[model samples]
Target: MKRYPIRAAKYAVYLIILFFILFALLRAFGSASPMSVLWTTSRGLMFLGVVVVFALLYPFFGFTRKRLTFNAAERADDVERIMAMCGFKRIGSENRPADDMLFEAASTAKKVAMMWEDQVRITTDADGVSFIEGNRKEVVRAAFRMGTYIA
Candidate 1:
């Protein structure tokens, strides 16, 4: 899986909001001693760290991986073009154990928006069955477009 180091601007704004919310909650329900400030800050930082980790992992665990099987007569090139129409650009192909074609978001901004899950890997078997593994929305969109035009 390829990683997009830069994230969308909205995510940074969201994280800032989350940090403030965590700090406010900690201050409200915390102890009322002089050292409570330090304690609350530490606890809020820890909680924020956990939330950030969960947000980072959400893309990997939250999406469903689906396979779209095309007819034997449909050419791989046609499928590649459909994927392009669906907002993915073919990076290249590799002769792995299975026939694999790799694709990424069409533009740099789209790639940043997708973050870590921008690349979609399509594996075509000898029987013309191709499995598209990526974010569920992207996979489904590509599958739907291919089905509409090719079927």
Candidate 2:
């Protein structure tokens, strides 16, 4: 999976704010005998709290923007390349196996190709099948491969 730098920065900013708030609360409520002790404790607590918050929120904000040259579209192309590596071809664009044949192949062979109107999905032993969604071809391909055929 790709990492989004902007989201990471946002998370950093959130942590900073959280740290300050925690530090302030500690200073406001704790003993005032030793300033150094208070500062050190507050800093430690702030760092630990921020780490915990980041861990809790990572999955939700992790994949917003990738710092890669490849955008979602390029990622889709990569997915297509992977499918080709798996002996899967574009449904109408390539000399692909027939629908029934592909289905049977998927059922019996260790690998299979699944095609949908908007996507192409593939499964192989080396690279397990994945479902992709959204405007990316990879997502679409994944969706096709993993999607259940609905009458």
Candidate 3:
């Protein structure tokens, strides 16, 4: 499963809010002693800290994250290269296939293309192109520009 950075961040924010709410409730209804309040607050902070850490690390550790970089132009070129590698031939208007197998293959190919598209993003710069994945936008040069072929 993919863990989106924005989603993780939102979850972290929610956890922080919940921790504060719990701390407040505990303070209001629990013991009035300084030690008890401090202990409760510390525990709440620890829980919030753990959530924050996990959120920050999720992008780096997520299995669905593809760590690759390319600029807009290079990205376009890569797409072309990948299409060629996948043996994707351009369908002519006059020779369009009208069979069920063709339709299934097209649908499957569209899904695979979408998956690759989602795995990478291209950003342009004066220095050239940069690729970004999720929240970590870093320029990587050794990306696998290969498309998946569904038979």
Candidate 4:
């Protein structure tokens, strides 16, 4: 079986907090017209919060990490360029065939979260380049910081 990065309790807590956030939104703004909802609704605001906060805080909490591994398609230090674009620095590289890349970054990439390490596993395929952290779910914020979120 594939091992999950987070424990069950943590997932439960994360879900509970998400529900609470939605509930709070419901309480704060539940009486909107259908037209306004079509344009932009309270639910949209909640979604924005979900993406911004989760991306900013997940690394701060040390919930996920990344590693660097290169395939035959990659050139030397290409991984470093990718990570740098994403606001990470190549701290240590093992030069091994597996998990040979290492990076360090701050949470929210604002120079905060010194206690946390922004580890990123650089995965590039024919589809596009990707950064996978703790789980299969794509955390876009943690990817290479494109403009606002991870691209």
Candidate topping lDDT: 1
Question: Could you tell me which 10 consecutive residues in candidate 1 have the lowest summed lDDT?
Answer: 1-10
Residue pairs with colliding backbones in model 4 are 66-119, 86-144
Which parts of model 3 are misplaced by more than 4 Å? 1-8, 11-45, 56-119, 125-132, 135-142, 146-151
RMSD of each: 6.9, 15.8, 12.8, 11.3
The lDDT values for all models are 0.66, 0.39, 0.42, 0.45
lDDT of 2 by residue, 1-151 (tens): 3333444555566666765677677779883334455347876667667675785566354322111222223244454444454344444424442211121112223222121212233323223322222224334433343232210
Instruction: Locate the minimum summed-lDDT window of 10 residues in model 3.
Output: 96-105
What lDDT tens digits, residue by residue, belong to model 1 across residues 1-151?
2432233233444566766676677668883334344337886567657656765765555455566756413466787788888888777555433367788899888876665458777777787776777877888888788778876
TM-score of each: 0.61, 0.27, 0.29, 0.38
Return the candidate ranking by lDDT, descending.
1, 4, 3, 2
Q: Specify the poorest-scoring 10-residue window by lDDT in model 4.
A: 142-151
What lDDT does candidate 4 reach at residue 144?
30
Model 2, which residues run further than 4 Å from truth?
1-3, 31-151
**Candidate order, TM-score descending:** 1, 4, 3, 2
Error of 4 at 119 (Å): 3.0
lDDT of each residue in 1-151, candidate 4, tens digit only: 1222333334445655675666667667974334344229777577556655564455444444443232412543554555566566655455533234455673464333332333545554554334356322222443333323322
Model 1 earns a TM-score of 0.61
Predicted candidate 3 versus true structure: per-residue lDDT over 24-132, tens digit per residue? 7866997444435534787646765788897677655542324234333444445434534433322331443211001111345643533322233333445653433
